[model samples]
Target: MIFNRVSYGFAAAAAGAFLFFAPAAQAMTKIERVVSPGGIEAWLVREPSVPLIAMEFSFKGGANQDPVGKPGVAYMAAASLDEGAGDLDAKAFQARAERNAVELSFRASRDEVRGSLKVLSDRKAEGFDLLRLALTKPRFDQEPVERIRAQMLTALKRETTSPNEIGSRLWWRTAFPNHPYSLPTNGTLESVPTIVRDDLTGFVSRTLARDNLKVGVVGDIDAKTLGTVLDQVFGALPAKSDLRAVPQARPEAVGKRLEVQLDVPQTVVAFGGSGIPRKDPDFIPAFIVNHILGGGSFSSRLYNEVREKRGLAYSVYSYLLPLDAAALFMGGTQTRADKANEAVGLIEEEIKRLAENGPTEDELEKSKSYLKGSYALNFDTSTKIAGQLVQLQVDDLGIDYWERRNGLIEAVTLDDVKRVARRLLNGGVLFTVVGRTQTAASAKQGG
Candidate 1:
């Protein structure tokens, strides 16, 4: 009998062991590139010990492809895929999935439409067939489309009063004013209702094509079997996507601050600035620098300064957020309305300090150790491995990135970290504050 679900109850224990005792033993699991008879290619990691399979695939052109007037069409279309497919109605399709003990879902992000499938090895055929149907023959039935659309609209309505959500949305809007990246993934209220079945169908047709697809699979699957499944699942897609080219953009509104006045007791602050891209040669050094500055949990400078030292906020940290079109270094904190300016001031001061002097040699060594030692936690399960593989492909990192990642971090010298720190943190930060703030008047006055 096939296991209905893969359990990771002991994953925490195993991860702990790996982190403490086997840190240096971190090694890349073998990855093989498989090409189908029809020429569909996929990255596969065969793990015969497990009886299940996990596959992740993505197609370029996500919400970024949504037409001028239709911002949420891609997101809605992804949600609609598993609702019904081919000859199966909504209920029947979901019933089939349950009977087969398969998990299938789709998501739309700023740069890609991604899908995930997990099933027992014995039921591979059924799992692949369901995925194929969702990709190539999604029914986009009226009922499912309306149901998902309504749910999204309700969420958007709730976002109006959500300080965190409001702050994040405002940050993006201010950062990428005229760009598609500024558009909400779930879309605005006006755009969700405008989405129709035709729009969903068109999105699938134009975006889900072979040329733009990247796939990664893990667990009890071999190269030969995966090659066959790849073609059976994706061979029917168009040779090329009809996606519009998205131009490169940088985060705007730097050195400016915007405040949305709310009656809430606590104010939420969201801030962002320029960042190094994933493909930049200095990315490894930049990653280390960020860890010492804010990416590290309790050990980071921001956390020590903002929360532990002054007790001005409950939490504060910053990290790199590299997107396909732009890169950003962003951070957030929540504090009492009265202390909002103090929190923002401390954040700015820390950023300036890092840019000016960079991390000390001790700070640099500690960050590299933590980063390298904690890397083993990412591969404690087949699903995690599969997810990492997919992300590596999306970032255009070479197939051997898993093996080389640790070395890259270890090789960053003190000079490299200081250089990247100055490069990334020298830029002005744009701040967006939501909720009651004593600084609101001054912020707006300056803007």
Candidate 2:
């Protein structure tokens, strides 16, 4: 899902333009911290060049907070927030948003519920008011509740037949069997219909609190003004959250392969194992090692070995997925059903090679240069800037992260990469494949 690109057209345009003209030379971003009179705090970046303002915020509770039988409560709650709020009905609220060119949206990931707002500077008051209303007084009207629930149900049904979707679902389910991470962020078909208005309301009431909130604002707003707006938007929420403590978990079913027999042309193979957490000292080194192994686009070893030389798959890559409660090294590729075993074998061989020999100096330098150059993409637009700032807060990266990031990457030596490679790549791997493969079926049956 991290790779899925949802088009916020204007936001995309701004990001694209910013990147296009960005200098190859790197520079540190200036970030300001603003604390409100009500004790609310936010990260702020002022950019008066654009008349529009973008704010991104997140709360700690997410799908992880859903009750045992209510898998998608947080997700459904996100969908219903803007449908109706305070005194406005669904249609009326939407109409008011459209009239002022305000863009408001919410999303639920495995660890957090995030919201984004974009509006013209002239309409800041209206935009802030609408957001406050949504946060504090969402109606969760029956019509909208049923409508959104139906939509999620439809998506779940569709996923049943999608190889990529099915493979991902089964991978997590198999990897974290007893943990909340095993459940789909969007509830299953059975769980979705059981969600009610009270479920949605309860999720919002318990999760949206001052203690767990992180916010970032960009464009046409000063610290003083943003401080006032922060309190106005968030001060009314409860000071504390009622979230349950999620226990730490790691991927299970390691060194095992599971197969689902779907009649798809290409087999979808999802593989992962243990990973370094964001707070770990070895994370940056692990990141550099991952880039050389698979995270780098076409230049990566996996891409070259799997796609170019052997033609086993069109794409192959891996990444470090550091969630709040768990960290993972995950990757996937699609290949002919009959070639699934061969593809998996090749991936394992490549991992072994990286673990044993590490990357060449040439590869390491190239990866470092690419990473340093692309850093500007993270701050290409007001929305993107705010989003990155909020994420930094969530990761507990210091306020000076932007300034320190490149130096951290630059300090990763060849020795460090090799050490982390052995640390991470030498672990047991879990593989989940969905397709018509005799080898896969045999593995599933313990053959």
Candidate 3:
């Protein structure tokens, strides 16, 4: 259910944002690979678009692999890599990267972690070397460790005060319980202080195995040269860990409604339960159903009912989150505390109605067309194509997943949508309300 893939093909940028879409006809996808002596392998795609090159390296068992008592170790390690590697301190590294117009980022999700590099095509060699150093020879110096720790602590403090963060934290804790999926990828306040440099060292040493790594290079590099680059970068890594030995996710406990009272003008409510797991046979159908239900903005039921019709909130929507082990489907909205209860009620009623009836033919058609039309946009640039490659590799989605993705979405039917909706939306749907004490009291008063 790892849903780092959750942000599907959402076009957050206008064509002008990246020099126009370059026409769908010009977009193409092909797979080529290189094998290193260390047994590390990389899949690459050559897109000679902008004078830019991008690569994504994905490692297995991101947050889920955190050892006992060191819940956030994996995430900290990912962040720390860029802080110092070899002779470059954080500042020096940033200077070098900016000087070369390189964008280097490391991010973690429940299932996998990623390190990405994007640079001018002419600077590919230097950028790749820098990335290699960060991966293979990161210098987890103590001074930067303390600085990073304090920064994270401050960020966590701010996040805890936010209503969206409050609801999400509570929901995962209730749903996953003892499971790794239950923990925040970013460590909790209490856990952050306990993570030390040695913790990071041990985690990276144990986790950065050759077989655990997969990379994709896209842009101006061809398969042969990319293979050589992959070897020089990740080729020396140790053997792969026993991947199958990883623990399986436990069944989610039935979640309960929780309300956190703060001083605020609006009440933010998140409602739903464990949805469809990523590897579940019904995942594709569940995704289609979710889009039809609330994922599609103007065309979705939640937008039409909650905003356009009643004007309850500025935004209202539902989404499915498939983690490595568990899936969560949630609908959310922010409204006046007095109207919060009514908003939650409307969301549930609509879910129940869909469970009983299913989407109409028109809704089904629109969702399909939207999904199909969006496929080409996935290859808009090297950065995006590289990212998609890493994700599909991590999911074992097969190299040809992009070629067949549209077909899968097209195969989903109205009956399939109803079946998944009915199967997923059941029991006491967990509801999380975050707002001021007065707002919580008002919502309770109406209840």
* Maximum-lDDT candidate: 2
Residue-level lDDT of model 1, residues 360-402, one tens digit each, is 9999999999999998787766667777888898899989888
lDDT of 2 at 148: 86
Per-residue accuracy of model 2 over 1-447 as CA lDDT, tens digit each: 211112244344345443232222232266789999999989987776666788999999899999887898999898888988999998898888776667788989999999988877877898899899999999999998888888888888888788888778878888888889999898888899898888888899999999999998877778999999998999999999999999999898888888888888999998999999999999998999999989997999999999999999999999999998888999999999878888999889999999999888899899999998788877656677889889999999989988889899999899999899999898878988888876536333110
Residue 252 CA error for candidate 3 (Å)? 4.5
RMSD of candidate 1 to the truth, in angstroms, is: 4.6
Greater lDDT among 1 and 3 belongs to 1
lDDT of 1: 0.83
Error of 1 at 334 (Å): 1.1
Which residue pairs overlap in candidate 1's backbone?
A: none
Per-residue lDDT of model 3, residues 22-94, tens digit only: 3243345567766755456777776666565777888886888787766777888887887778899877876
Query: How does model 1 score by TM-score?
Result: 0.93
TM-scores for every predicted model? 0.93, 0.94, 0.88
Tell me the whole-model lDDT of each prediction, alpha carbons only.
Answer: 0.83, 0.85, 0.73
Backbone clash pairs for candidate 2 read none
- Model 2 clash count equals 0
Model 3, position 110: C-alpha lDDT score = 73
The TM-score between candidate 3 and the true structure equals 0.88
Provide the lDDT at 170 for model 2.
78
